[model samples]
Target: MEWLERMNRAIDYIEENLTGDIELSEAARMACCSSYHFQRMFSFITNVTLSEYIRRRRLTLAALELQHSGVAKVIDVALKYGYDSPVSFARAFHALHGITPAMARQDGIALKAYPRLSFLITIRGADAMNYRIETKESFEVFGIEGIFRTDGDGEAPQTPAKLWEQSHANGDVKQLEARAGVLPSFVSQDLYPVNAVCSYRKTGPDTFPYMLCAFKEENSNTDGYTTVTIPAYTWVIFPSEPHQWEQFGDTIETLYRRFYTEWLPTAGYEQVDGVEFEMNGTKNGLNYIELWFAVRKI
Candidate 1:
């Protein structure tokens, strides 16, 4: 996260201009990256989407100004943040703070304040990651999936525990695993929509029936599991330390953020269409784990 210093600098720039026009292109320059790349990196590193963060921060400031300052006109506040009118700002403010601007101004409503972000590089290079880039035909995956939403940073859905419990109680997951060790995948869906985290198993591409996949096509041989054909692509494989299960989501998020925000820009790789995969070697205590991703040269 050494490069996070640049992110912090960018945050400072945002804070300084919350009252003025804040452009995505300008912010990208502050971060020393292109707008698309900066926005993507910002979402990954912060674990909160950039647009969401800005909206929250803006509303928080507006609420504070209403409470503590002399800005009596809602339209004025809205215009200051680039909103077209009071109605628009109020709508956005309600979405973020769960209350309309007028109500919040009069009733002292609670608001979410997104503090400026800071990134610090930590040195822990001991953990070994096992992964390799792969090139295969485009594929499809089929399996029953459940969507889980994160409450905020580090607040993932509890569905995994439930899914595992129900699957084991019904002996469905065990049966499925017995068929083959299918790897679970974490996918970013709906382009940063609230509660957009989904977990799934590979099926097949453009096939009538989809199948749940366990491990890579090479690892297992089983009857129930289906093979999905995937297009050839480069991949990055990372290994997790022995016995670190509780922090799986946090660790994965951190690594992915660093890989995208810090590593990939200089590493000369761009994401390609392929399902991201997570391999857990030891489920009982998390002795080790691996993450697989698809990529190609920029």
Candidate 2:
């Protein structure tokens, strides 16, 4: 319930500022999280990016105003909703409503509307989530890193998967795997296999750096990848049940969805400012993946 309140408060902030400049940071503050985490949580829970949600809501209101107000000018309505020019505004407006801003003034015209958002929970079947918490010493990892923007008018966050594919295609993954021990058979539990993502204090307004890498073993070779050090922190680890290799993606995604929706709100913990791991490997001829979220007791 508290989590719902924080999120709904954030929605209220967005709703109140629909006609003016809405600072995502302020909305995150109302939700008691960093801007990046808030956006991530929002996307996961709502299946919509925060920026796109805001855009839809703004356009919904602008459409209503344009349809009702006989005196409303297209340029003035466009500026009210943060578009600097009528052309850009019309482009966005038509994309959402399938009609132009000028057409919006025609009586009996149709427009799409996205109502304000509020967070709530619904009781489903007796599903279970598996997780553990561990506090470990600070560690260092080496890998290839790329900065990605969280907010845009694009598709869902596929950057992580894309990064993995790129590494595999370009021999980056092979290079690291060649020097590193194979999982389960030779790698220590401390060695996050080839799956760890890290440290933050949001690097940019809409961008965060994601790494495709592994824990730096003392004698392991680091010939090509850059190394990054992550400070000590507590992590909540969620492990999906061991399954066949073909089910890896679905299993991991379900685990992540449960982590944010079923765990974070009720578990009395919050994702902290540090590293996270997508700890994965094979054991007993079955593949498995775990999500390690750096967290603190709320």
Candidate 3:
């Protein structure tokens, strides 16, 4: 199946199972992508977390059921939508629609509706997207790593910035740069920050490791840092225009949005399970970066 078709089918699956327990793994499976990639891509494309989307959807349906079915009790509606208790259901409902179930059922209450989502590819003017596909052998990256979670507003939290500050203050970045055997020219290059998942477990809060790293050999000295092995995989590289240090964050976020919504659907490749990295550097007095996404041909 095509990438678009698979994505739409995933949406269909979510709609069908909204009232039941939905697993991120199953949703990604329906979309033919890994859970990590699916969640990231879904958030980038829709600007909402997967859980938030599911919650809004369930609440929307629950509100309708409560308003229309005069005989249906609030507890029945809540349980039907997978809420364990009426209290929990009312809390979530009020949070989303700004009104409780009883208020919604009253004469003149307005309830917000989040209709089901369907995706379609629309063509605008053809603006060239600069990227290259390349396969590399396995490699290792050594650096300071920390865990960060996504905020409620769908923004990556400030934990990563705190990690970088700690690393810089303690001279860990310099230590890793001096130990670099490969990419020496860019070793001390403070531009690129590599982010990857050591392991993805499907329970609890969503979090992942973000690393400030450089290329290292297998026999690199064990010091005050950690190392992660990146297996061989094909990568799609998106290089950005030169920008100032302050603009780096916004630039990368824009690139991600473009990658998911504009590039991947037409790039003739599907994402694979592997590490993603950013290559940062400076040229002609302007800082630049490149995003690398692991993928395989569809």
Candidate 4:
């Protein structure tokens, strides 16, 4: 459980610095992974963004202090929690505890509490994940991309989600498909060829670069698109069991959650520094996507 131990050390760093500036990159270092991977893994495991978790923790500590310390001023508590002013503090406090900070000091008052978080092993069910490993030559893809920041202060970073919405709304999705020629059988016909591409090497720390791209063949139009080459590497591709289009988001979330929590801990390979693919395809009259992870032998 070395990986989990490293993760806990990162959490310890956050808890110690909750009232001060938290360096997300340091947390990732403590966990022995990139900031991008740390944020994503934390979200998948906890079902909450790192930022939201931090907010709840700060509010939880504030409530406890208010309820017990008679001399602790509300404004002081707000300041201690890094809130700029009382009004902003109160708003955030009320959102979490359903009562004003002053009201928290009253007797018989009830407030919500979010305890510190830690990870441990559990008996996961025997659900199988169908995956294949392959090493292919370098390939190029062309599409539009957006720069997204990683949430380092335990905040959730809005990302690929926003990119997906923009592409769909702006007709980038339709345009890419119309420009695409004949694709391999493995390619998805339901939504896109490649739904989203995220990786560690193509960008900087504290930043996640995502692209809504498709396989760029020779003579593929390069205008109005950014072309990137995906270097050759061993990939572990997990093909999701087919399900309705309505279940797309839920299905993908489940797949990620399981991969990090259940599979990686025991797998013989470790995820390396490279790009990941969310490839779209269809099966059983439904939609599916293959999760392509860059990996190397552990």
- Candidate number of the best TM-score: 4
lDDT of each: 0.56, 0.78, 0.75, 0.81
Cα lDDT of model 2 by residue, 1-298, tens digit: 7778899999999999988989897888888876777888898888888989999999999999988997899999999999999999999998999999889889789788898877777675688777778887776777777666656424444476777887888888878876654443323354335775844446765566788776677666877777787778888888777799889878977887788888887888888843467777766668878788988887
Candidate 1: tens digits of C-alpha lDDT, residues 1-298: 3345556788888878877876766776666654544665678867787777777788888888777665578888889887998888988888887877777666556776766666665454654434455554544443334433322222332345555556557766556555443332332111111011122222222111112234333344445444444555556766555557577677767667657645555456654432355545554445455556666775
C-alpha RMSD in Å of predicted model 4 compared with the true structure: 3.3
Candidate 3 runs further than 4 Å off:
145-162, 181-210, 218-220
Task: Give the number of the best model, judged by lDDT.
Answer: 4
- lDDT (Cα, tens digit) per residue for candidate 4, span 219-248: 466688887888888888888888898998
Q: By TM-score, rank the candidates, best first.
A: 4, 2, 3, 1
TM-score of 4: 0.88
lDDT by residue (tens digit), candidate 3, 152-259: 233434566666677778887667666664453423344533333333222223445567776676545647777777778888888888899899899888898899
10 residues in a row with least lDDT, candidate 2? 183-192
Where model 1 places Cα greater than 4 Å from the true spot, the runs are 1-43, 47-52, 61-71, 74-142, 146-169, 181-212, 215-227, 244-254, 283-286
Q: Model 2 segments beyond 4 Å from truth? A: 152-158, 181-192, 200-202, 244-246
Q: Which structure is stronger by TM-score: 1 or 2?
A: 2
Q: Output the worst ten-in-a-row residue range by lDDT, candidate 4.
A: 151-160
Clashing pairs in model 4, backbone N/Cα/C closer than 3 A: 50-154, 50-155, 51-154, 51-155, 188-281
